[model samples]
Target: MDIKEYIVIAIAINAGKTILGIYNSDVDLKLDQSPLTLADRKSHYIIKNKISQTKLPILSKEGRKVSYQHRRIWSKYWLVDPLDGTKEFIKKNGEFTVNIALIENSKPVMGVVYSPVLDILYVGAEELSAFRIKQASELLKYLTLINDWRNYAESLPLLSTINIFRIVVSRSHLTKETLEFINSIRDQHSEIELISKGSSLKLCLIAEGYADIYPRFAPTMEWDTATGHAIINATEGKVCQADENNKESLLNPKFIAGAFNVDEKRINNHGR
Candidate 1:
């Protein structure tokens, strides 16, 4: 689908999230420990229904689980986390997001993440590249008249070698493994800075060039990182495998990183 179509779908799904989040806040907002919520369920339904029009198979957090016996046969599918960051949503911090990613051969090739509360959308595809689009403030006047407003793309700025390295981490799910990884890097890179954020926005920061790296050591399903990973890859970054022996070392073709102009040897050495 084209970017315009994806934007419309994203906006519609985000509207559902906003409505449910507002309506459910007064009801005690029970947490399932797993972070399930009415907003998550509702948003999942809305997004699933819309994407169902294409008759594509989907592996969603809220949807029925097809056995791996059957799913392993498919070459392409949609991986979705209808509502990411249930903790932030319940806290009313507006850091949650809606994620949809197209996975092919165990890798996400396209992704769209929409934050309704913030009115920000991040879309990426292998061929089209990745971009962040936001609505114009003045366009709010035509909200009723115009179904979709024009969006301005946010581009990544150039980085200076001496600039501080900003690392993005999860606010609610920090783990010992993650800490060790951070410590290992900090020992070598003294200027490293940490920015804790909720949900898939961690990857968005890297895509937008706001952060240099994001190390996720805790358990996360494929859907959780697929969308953001695709966007990061589009921006000349990659998500490679973390070294089994050293948490700080990134394993090639597994760990993800954005595109860098440096030689492969330097990139591999830097991660180690």
Candidate 2:
């Protein structure tokens, strides 16, 4: 990990601590019909404050919205979702995560997704390989061994075998389109198994090879998938949009992710 990656990880760990604090308390409702908590607000403040040291503009869910008119002028920026999966958080399912990514030229160059409940941190950067730090070690301990953290971490694509078509979908939320997409693939894979997970972990599962694909047919903001995209792309997996012709859009549509050679035929065929 470099200096930027180190800072992002530290911030995520700190933010995760804040989120856990709020998780133990009552949550409130947002105007957008989603759950909100002090953790969300506090995490946003903490990340924004820390990332400001890099002197990069941030496009966070809780911060001022930056339209493409202005956002396009920047060569780089910070994309963050202080706390993802508020619904899961409200349900206390321990599937929520805090996501942070460094975006350069519309692509996530560095990513970190931290789950406070699970005490798992997944990180990936441009020159650095993706790695996961689990409950066995303290996250900040890497601060002292930034260049050698890989020595204490587990590399990505955790599995080398692709046994069957395994899929990851939202446990608390699913869409008709997603179901249809799954059925479309069932023709090619009879032993397809479906796993339910919340937050950006779905993408992380695909990155580490615990699952093969996560198709998102419902709506999702840029921040929701940016970090996941980075981690997935760091390995052999990827997150893509519906428009095959336009690859620059950060907003997600119906998309599919899998290994490098995983047939994207289904997504291209089902493009809406």
Candidate 3:
């Protein structure tokens, strides 16, 4: 099996399953006021332990804080968010995901995202493009199923003739800037559909062609978007920084992500 299909995909699945195991644990607030749980720690350790076999440095949101000075020198590393959407997980909404990405030269070359509750997996790489698998939770213990899974997996940007202009936004984080962005989109497209999703699923919707665009004007860390960005790129889509000035920062600038064949004029005008 390919590394992305076997290692990255498996690691995400394992971490996601571990998270689901502790789904009902008590939730505490971090210094940033984000929810934290035993599941987050368990998933982080599980991914850290397994992915260490690759011998590449790891940058995980849940892991130790690696100084930018230390991280700047590494040409290649594994970027992980062991448990994304802590709020959604706490809400039992099943929109949380385990995100893993391979970064080289400051760009994501490969990625895997697994949603434990939904039992879906999305994987992508420069070489392999992108794919989405249903019932991916069942592949956790069965390595032999990799080939079968790949065969059955749906290629990303699945729809070729979508009519309505769909915009996906964070369920828990609808900011004033986001609303303004939506209103701007409404001015351009007569038929607009708004989708409320949690976590990286917003990006996944664009990758799978379920949504046309995802405008994230709220704050988000690099790890939160890295996996989804890679998948979208694999499908010939864009995850562009809203501000070109902050392109070098570790914290992602406000951004807009869109599916392949989306109106470039829309993105070019708004994703500045």
Candidate 4:
């Protein structure tokens, strides 16, 4: 791994420390009726401190949202959601994650998703394919020997054991539109499996071939799915905005990740 990648992993691991600490604490409410603990704030601070050194403007869920006029002028920027699946964290389900993505021309060019409770990390870039470390040892082993972590990552779309038309969906925020999509698919395919997953890890699971697709009909911000979009796109997959035909805007939009052929296209990483 390059020094920049190593630094990002280190920052994510340090932020995980804060996340786990807050997970064990009493949970409460944040904005939009969501939960926020010290983890969110600490992770945001740690990631911003390290990533800011790259001199790219960062857009994070915790930080103030930048005006479109200001952000559109940039050719590149950092996108992050310091703590994803806070509800799962509050539930102590060990499904929350840290997400970071690099946006070039409003498209995710690189991404990293770390699950502290699972001790796993998923990374992908324009220059490299997507990969997942089954167990990252809380990033300790990576800190000790970066080469080992880099060498051990399993490539995306791991061989599937079953020939099932699997569909992975959000565990907490399932919508009627999503259900309708699933029902429609079941008519064409005989063997259908619905997998429940939380956080951006839902996208990683699809990249790993655990699920065939992730069709999210509910709303999502760019930060929430940019890293996942990058990782999946690296695997020759697509994460598109289903609402607009042009799909040029990167604001909130409906997202569906898989090998779907759609008129509106937002090509990411150009198949790597």
Our model 3 lands, by Cα RMSD against the true structure, at 3.2
lDDT of each: 0.65, 0.78, 0.81, 0.75
TM-score of each: 0.78, 0.88, 0.90, 0.86
Which lDDT tens digits does candidate 2 get at residues 66-92? 666777777788889999998888667
lDDT per residue, candidate 3, 68-154, as tens digits?
A: 777888888898888889878766788899999888887888888998888899988898889998888775556475567778689
Candidate 4 lDDT at 179 equals: 88
Compared with the true structure, the alpha-carbon lDDT of candidate 3 equals 0.81
lDDT of 1 at 70: 69
lDDT of each residue in 1-272, candidate 4, tens digit only = 67666767777777876787766655554333333556788899999999988888888889945676776677888888999998887667889999988888767888999998887888888777888886665446435666666677788767766778778999999999888877766776679989998999899887787787788877777778888888887887777543321123555666668732222242231111
Runs in model 2 lying further than 4 Å from the true structure: 26-35, 141-143, 160-162, 242-250, 264-272
lDDT of 4: 0.75
The C-alpha RMSD in Å for every predicted model, in order, reads 5.6, 3.4, 3.2, 4.8
Name model 1 segments beyond 4 Å from true: 1-12, 15-24, 30-36, 136-151, 156-162, 242-272
For candidate 1, the lDDT comes to 0.65
**Candidates arranged by lDDT, highest first:** 3, 2, 4, 1
